[model samples]
Target: MAINLVKGQKIDLTKGRSSLSSIMVGLGWDPVETKKSGGFLSGLLGGGGGGADIDCDASVIMLDENGKLKGKENLIYFGNKKSKDGSVVHSGDNLTGEGEGDDETINVDLKRISPSIHRLVFVVNIYNARQKKQDFGMIQNAFIRLVDNQSKEELVHYNLTENYAGKMSLIPGELYRQGNEWKFSAVGEGTMDADIGSIANKYA
Candidate 1:
């Protein structure tokens, strides 16, 4: 069974489980539905009339021991699907959050991560949100989860239930190293950061 987490909660990832080397981080969301005939959902369903379909892009930032970015190649997203070291890989962008399950996923190899890397921050942002007039408030049922890659067993899950009105970016969760072990934390925080570059600049 997976442990459902609340905001600010943290759990051990590879402490007791010596065999846990790789894991998958999944993020998902859906566009808010409206009663009107044509809207975002309609656009996604192939009908036309609503505002443009929401394009939410999921990304990961790999930080060093100081919790800061050391290189540009450490950022993983649709354009850059994998880390230079191959420790982290992204599943690519999801133009519409119309799916039933995870819209995007990032795979992490614990043993392959460099010793200097200490944190993996999972984030999601609206593509061209400022122009498309989209935000998290327009999205619903957003969640992030961690799963055992080999066993395909979910380990931790967090549902972001807060109202992120006018927020273009979300920091769903993070994985950080403590000594030689890794842990997961449910961040569930929202920000107005426009794009991945602006968000990464904060740590750079």
Candidate 2:
């Protein structure tokens, strides 16, 4: 069974697993239902009534030993789907959180990551949140998980259950290196960041 994690918890990803090198990280969320449902009323409401689709873009900001971005190309999202070194790859943008399970996924090759890069911070932000007047308050069942890419088995799962009403972005979790091993931290922190670029600035 996969370990269910709470906010602030951390887990070791490559401690004893000698052969483990690649892993799949999945992120998912759903929009909360509104009683209004569709039409001009829903559009004006931003969501639920279905005025506009809540485009939550998942991104990974690669950082160095000093906890800072080394280059602009290290940031991976819908526009830039893969890392320059080819160690990390994003599945692509999920325009709408309309379906079940992992709306977006990012695959990481532990062995392929550059030695200088020490952290992979996973973030999710509502696209044009301020313009659309949307936030996590219109979202539900947000989660981040890791799977053993080779065996297709889930190793860790973190369901973010927080009241992020006015929040526009989330730093769900991150993978950082400790010596030769990688560790996963369940960081369920919400932010008022307007987009992925704003979220990446904190580490810049």
Candidate 3:
């Protein structure tokens, strides 16, 4: 079982696990059906002219020791699925939050990552949310977890159940370096700006 983490909590993954080289950060979420005040059939099916498949995308931003963006290519998402040095790789994009389990999985190799890169931040945003008028408020069961790839054991997990109506982006957590040790932090923060591009621009 994974550790159900609270906001602002920190976990040191590299403490006892000397063999913890690779980890899979799995993210999961489900869409909340928007109820409509219409006919019986419309209400039965929860039909809504506005409701549609919410496309949520997960991304990883590699930052230097000073918490600065290394480069644009370091931002891994559906657009750029792989990192430059092949240290970090996003599995793929999850268009809809329908399927069971993680919507997006990001793989990180401790050995492959550059020493200068201090942190890898995990972010999720609804694709074209401004056009869809969607945010985390309408989404439920949103979570991000870290696991030991080899052992198949979940190290830490955080489930977000907050009302983020006007926000479109979520800063779930981050994997950072503590001397030779690596640690994970659960940060469930939200932002109102549109897409991932706007969020990335802030760091650039």
Candidate 4:
């Protein structure tokens, strides 16, 4: 079943018959532009920035019982590996922003997680490709969803573009579990330059 989660709702995983063995987190958004055309010459000559374009890098984190990182072993980050940053690894940065295929998918093996794990966090970063200061209002249908692999169910869904900030962020949704299925919802919508830390602080 597809579960639509609103802000402030909590899903108690321990109450479920099956203690979340694994979780798949998917980040998706409506692509602003499908293709980019022309060059600076075409623009300077009278073309202007061709087509609407939105590019981004995103990541996810898991919070342990003590409200600290479960380390790289418990988390999956996607995007550029710039400056050898521990969490900068990305599956692939989508430039087209076409909202197709898997923009960002993080698979967590619950078996590997210590019993101490308490929450999961998601973060999305918009690259500001156009270098313009715009808010999430310019975007549409952006969301984060958690799925159960065994039952093929959508455990939780969060609609963010309605009231989220552009740039780096912690997706304001946390998933635990409820009645054999995980549950989650947007908690507090806020923007931050630090994706990993902001997420960790929620449980901390």
Q: Which candidate gets the maximum lDDT versus the true structure? A: 2
What candidate 2 gets wrong by more than 4 Å, as runs, is 36-51
Candidate 4 Cα lDDT to native? 0.54
Over all chains combined, what TM-score does candidate 4 have?
Answer: 0.65
In the range 1-204, model 4's lDDT, one tens digit per residue, is: 656766666655434535556666677765443233575433332344434555655665666655566455545554322212232133556664575544666665555544555555666655652354433433446777767667667777766645453444546566653324444657646575544544455544
Question: lDDT (0-100) at residue 132 of candidate 3?
Answer: 73
Give per-candidate clash totals: 0, 2, 0, 5
Q: Model 2 residue 86 lDDT?
A: 98
Candidate 3 residue runs with Cα over 4 Å from true position = 35-50
User: Order of candidates by TM-score, top first?
Assistant: 2, 1, 3, 4
lDDT for each candidate structure = 0.90, 0.91, 0.86, 0.54
Cα RMSD to the true fold for all candidates: 3.6, 3.0, 3.1, 6.9
Q: Which segments of model 1 are wrong by more than 4 Å?
A: 37-51
lDDT: which is higher, 2 or 4? 2
Q: How much is 1 displaced in model 2, in angstroms?
A: 1.7
Which scores higher on TM-score, 2 or 4?
2
Per-prediction TM-score to the true structure, in the order listed: 0.92, 0.93, 0.91, 0.65
Error of 3 at 24 (Å): 0.5
